[model samples]
Target chain A: MDDLPSLPAKLARLRHAHPGDFNLSRIDPAAQPCSRGGKAADKVRVEELAVELDGLQNRFWADRRHRLLVVLQGSDTSGKDGTVRGVFGRMSPLGVHVVSWKAPLGPERERDFLWRIHAQMPGNGEITVFNRSHYEDVLVPVVEGDLRGKALQRRYRQINDFEQMLTETGTVIVKFMLHISREEQRVRLQERLDDPEKAWKFDPKDLEVREHWDDYQRAYRDAISATGTRWAPWHVVPADSKTHRNLMVATVLKATLQSLDLRFPPLPKGLAGVRVK
Target chain B: MDDLPSLPAKLARLRHAHPGDFNLSRIDPAAQPCSRGGKAADKVRVEELAVELDGLQNRFWADRRHRLLVVLQGSDTSGKDGTVRGVFGRMSPLGVHVVSWKAPLGPERERDFLWRIHAQMPGNGEITVFNRSHYEDVLVPVVEGDLRGKALQRRYRQINDFEQMLTETGTVIVKFMLHISREEQRVRLQERLDDPEKAWKFDPKDLEVREHWDDYQRAYRDAISATGTRWAPWHVVPADSKTHRNLMVATVLKATLQSLDLRFPPLPKGLAGVRVK
Candidate 1:
């Protein structure tokens, strides 16, 4: 990847667009499109970027002008948790929040799909990361054949409108799809089974979902094509290499924060030299 | 203070229950009733207790059988935020959540006060800390004369019944009233004005409320007496000394967690010796 151009320009190449020509199978999940160099170099760069991002986050929190919402959507074992720890872990807990979306229960199920999601949106000066977000509504339903045709299209439209409204009200949105190959997932799943420490993370239900891999890929592609609007575009990240995945996310996030031009508010009047005593 | 007895026994002295003789003017805000020793000793003990509490929180999260809700209510500069940081900050953010309540805005005002609060209640295996809580309904409204007579009594009854339902459903509630002297608040508020970094936290409306200090104090006393139940007892914490305040809160919390007898859930059958691979 070229380092001379603006970060957004570099990232735009990986963003999913041109729906007519979009095909999930064409993108190689093992590709390192965003890598600065070798795995060692990429890992170092991720750490550097994480630090830079943390500085931006401090300014963003002090700026109190914009809300940032990051939505991470991917297949099971696609590195959502890893991405959060790598990219957002450096930020202050006071300013950054993570909401891991699980299956709706009780009252949440009674409301609209977006109800709970809307409630968790980032407030001004805050950043909220959604792990497996509202996008799940479109993917799981389509894969399970619960939603089809017009109903699915309506949900896509609803998400687009909702996101547009959020953007219009000063929320900066970034959506990432962590794409990993089926073979890579198999190795990870096996590793989870082999490591006692990782066993707790391996849900048996993941295997059931793996059986519908093709359907899920199709569902993901369709949903991304429909809902990847200008306001909230989706970046399909090739995530087979955990280091590369972290690097790419941290890079895109740093670029996003830079674009905001965050700055701290001016000190209150007459407090420049005021003594606490 | 003696350290020989169990932790709960030491903390029992701070838990308020006598509604008939409950007087806001009687409790000394500067008293260190729950402190283990001098300021330096209490600070170290607070740190020790915080780590201990973190261990218990891990077990609590893994247990997934009980829910914990911590309510922190106090006047301005009463150290609600400090309590969260000093007491619960060491715990994993995954298991601990903080909801800093502000004045009702938009649709929150449309519904009853408890509606928003009820929505934020902890799910199983989670601990939620409410910086300011549902008790605000009684204090703010009563001080402003919007709630009084039979209407106010009804709200107290409603709160009692609501808490009873939560306790029946396996939620353990701990309420803390951070009592700070009026002079101490004035000093803290002035410090905020003097320090540029803390200026943002200094809301001008705080001065407006400070003018109603006596009314708010009476309101707090009334609310605490009415809503404090056996299931959700209120502990009046002397918060003039930040270290002492943290120590008392942590000591009370440590005792509360111990009382629950938190334990990790049993591993899945066949997984005790099963290889992950």
Candidate 2:
């Protein structure tokens, strides 16, 4: 009855209707590899989406009041950086803004994780992306002895309420938890080490956490299950392949922006040419 | 005699050398018919520069301390916005930041014009571009009657000093005044009026200013000649063709960035893969 479709059912229908579109080659949490059939079609769609996104971004610049925020959360090597470049690459310069959350600033470190994030929220008619977001506070700190017990519980509550408020204030939060198998991450990390161009990406710090990969998985499951909601829902994306990752993300992004029914604002009439003679 | 080449000659050499490296066809600032050049070498060179620019932009992101400032000033339909998108599109989302100055904000209008521009100056390791800049205080207001006599002279002095300060603090200012013949502008204005898609771009107010084109040109020449310095200089780009324009601008941008000699910061050793066991 609502104007919006039930997101869960919509996702389920999409998965069923476009079974070939799903990237099965990506192993799930269990480390068992799955394979899919429509890689070529998926790639073409992504290119199309990139161009459409350019138009949408330009429209956002022209319209000036609608702002979009994309949140990417996932295991290491889930293609967050690449997706950002691929999906939003065609956007015009002034229309989009991307903030990748790393170590917080001095003031940010003192306050809650969400405080710094809130500060970077997009103004009207812009798009802001969080490469790794507030979820890191819950995921990283909880897994690594940075925060524990009641502090963790309080954070989850704060995150839910914070997102709800953001949604109420015209922010559309599309959260993606990039799901990948331990085996895939191992292979990916090895590739980073082997490829000279990618060597800069190889951080030995990733392996220490790789040992406790199961703990991180459990944390992600809990965080996603708890925070997934009507206004700001979480999408569990299988991201073993970069192409699949870009397509899934673009499909969701296009659907979300299109739902807004963006159109060019009417220009003032008689603006053609003024007679100065 | 310095490591830097002769500024004026170096820029002119670069522009002439990269005839095929920029796309100047799309930016027809005149009311004439479109023309095509059949130089395969030029087409190939333009493509090469596009790729090179991608690499340069990545290095810019990795370097982080070298900020880029592209200042675009031009007549109506001079293609400033298009140049920005075409030239800087491939840069990392993190490194490039664009600030388009408009009729002053309430707070901005009260303070000196240079004040608003200064606040938007790029932080260390970022790129800040001004679509139109503080020159407007001296250029537009003088042409429009909003500024005159003692006030105009005072503002001009304030701007030159302000820019010197920005250069002193490590801002690399590359100013471009897009130069199109009056006949070219007439063609562009008519194009906007003729094409429905571009109908929104035609503003009658622009024509009122067109009447005083020579006055504005004289003002531009005086201001640029006065303010051009070793730290920051204005490049007057001929803008009759978009291909020539894009190539010329990209070459200038490349020459400026290459001169910076950016290299990736050394990564901390031992930060790579830690044993998870």
Candidate 3:
């Protein structure tokens, strides 16, 4: 009943167990998980998964019982927005919503950290994609030395509590920690600067955050370890290869959706065989 | 040099020592701790404190190092709006800002309970008054039975952590639990209905919460108990008399600002005695 090896095995390897067990540095970003063979095949698989996802999403929308939240968290230029487009582009926009988080500004910054993120949660049967998320609260603050020790631990606990509540209340959360190497990031960031089409995405402020690359990696590992739960588990996505990143994410989404046993909801009472008015 | 009796003693009595030490049911709503004889004199003193507050606010604006956050929490018609007017009416609006927290709606409800409140915090050299505040998250949900036991405890902890951060980052927080009786609330609710001018302020939803009066009282007690920390202590202000409420709040503001010993930044480097050309 389950074709688990290629998909679950990779995710299982990537799935962080606890704060003490996970190490971020050893995982190679270039290593393709759930790959078919090469980049061309991986791209083809992404398209297939996108179509299956579309079908599953339609059922998901009709089922209207569960909510799906795909959280894509990574450093800048690790392709969050691109992942959204590649993995979810074919799905109908009506049920699929994407929110790209940024630095909390005037209104967002004034309150407790999680307000903005919570306000953007997907309603029942809808799939919401977070380009970056509340995880950034833990990361940026940790690396910049703004939040340390107990404060950081508290945030992790807060997130776990929040996700547990979400799961208990019907939100099926699948978090992806897109793993990319420092070298790969440098190349991608350079592309952002070099390509005029991509130059607009580059922030000089990002370079400052990038300067804390190793720190962010450590932050990410710590965050993943502390926050990953049985309910909302973290899956590390090797994202150096665009094809592999999209493919792995799309495949995971398919597996997640399929596991739900979603179906088009039955007709309402007294309308089972009724046609249009 | 300190006139301690008429101020600090009252606050000391009202100040909750810890969650276990405070009992809401034992406190009288009609008790006036800081009243100077009668309503007429108290009203006049409110005007005087308003004047003093305006002067202190100017110094506070110039000081630019410390921020003030005054949190007002109470049942409906506990005189939050009236206190804001009577106490802050004379202060220069440039330095004093008021945020009236409402029930979290569309954008606000989606995030964690604290986001909206956090976004509304005062910047340095400013006094921000919260007419209603983050305390509502703990109170309302508890009264409505949406949160219980450990979940409730976690929220209180989250609040303490939040307020701790605010205080550590230069914000001085004064939280007031405006204590009003069930009878006072009935009279007030009746006024809203009887007075057409006040009818618009009435929400039908409020009546439902009002019905849960005892539950809410218990919730408030629990909230004040758990959240009242050394950094941000809770002061229970008996709010039956609007004049006393305003007078007490105004006097507290005066005391808080005076203790800061704010002085204008010494005429910026070379401009100590320079005249405008």
The lDDT values for all models are 0.81, 0.69, 0.77
Best by lDDT: 1
Worst 10 residues of 1 chain A by lDDT: A1-10
lDDT of 1: 0.81
Error of 3 at A166 (Å): 0.6
lDDT of 3: 0.77
What TM-score against the true chain A does chain A of each candidate get? 0.95, 0.85, 0.94
Per-prediction TM-score, please?
0.77, 0.81, 0.50
Q: Model 3: per-residue lDDT, tens digit, B1-277? A: 1232335675676776455647888888898888879889888888888878877876787678899999888998898867766776555444566666778899897899899988978887878888889888898778777999998889888998998899889998888888898888888876665554454455666667777888988888888878777788787888998888877777777777777777765422432332211
User: Could you give candidate 2's per-residue lDDT for residues A76-179 as a string of tens digits?
Assistant: 78778788777877676676777777767788889867778888898777788888999888888778778777887788778888987887887777777777
Docking class of 2: acceptable
Pitting candidate 1 against candidate 2, the one with the higher DockQ is 2
Ranking by DockQ: 2, 1, 3
Q: What is the lDDT for B109 in model 2?
A: 75
Tens digits of per-residue lDDT, candidate 1, A1-277, equal: 1121346565565776433335767778998877867888888888888778878887898789999999999998999977876777655455677788998999999999999999999889988989899999998888998999999989888998999899999998888999999888888887777665465577777878999989999998898888777678788889999998898888878877887777756556655554332
Per-model chain B TM-scores are 0.95, 0.83, 0.94
